[model samples]
Target: MKINKEEKTPWICDKCNKELQLSEIKVVYLGGSFEVELMQCPECKMVLIDETLALGKMIEVEKGLEDK
Candidate 1:
């Protein structure tokens, strides 16, 4: 998998007011779990999702899945 560097430069947490850390997270949707790399707040562990994933692959895969 490839990541766009320009889209994921750096980020800070609004609640903690601290720099975010790059980590792999488990995201579950519709009874399915996926491991994705995201920027998260070290203090709060709040995961961040970018527009590329939200509007791109995330939505694409969502439409292709069934409840079974």
Candidate 2:
């Protein structure tokens, strides 16, 4: 699905405060149209979605790391 560029908000890694890129990241659905960007830094493990919403489902195919 084409991500809405207008809705593509800039994400900064909490660990390093570095800006994220779509090509070097991923979106794990956590319900209510929220998502998680599974990055490499340890801080990336933090929930990327709304805290009020319960985490829905996470699917990882091919067993490849989000960032090469």
- Residue range 1-68, candidate 1, lDDT tens digits: 98876785569899999899989998776555678898999999998998986787677567768533
Give the per-residue lDDT of model 2 (tens digit) for 1-68.
88876885667777678665433344544232324444343445443443332332333322233433
lDDT (CA) per prediction: 0.82, 0.44
Worst 10 residues of 1 by lDDT: 59-68
lDDT of 2 at 3: 81
Query: Which candidate leads the pack in TM-score?
Result: 1
Residue 27, model 2, lDDT: 51
TM-score per model over all chains: 0.72, 0.27
Task: List ranges where model 2 is wrong by over 4 Å.
Answer: 1-7, 22-54, 58-68
lDDT of candidate model 2 versus the reference:
0.44
- The TM-score of candidate 1 is 0.72
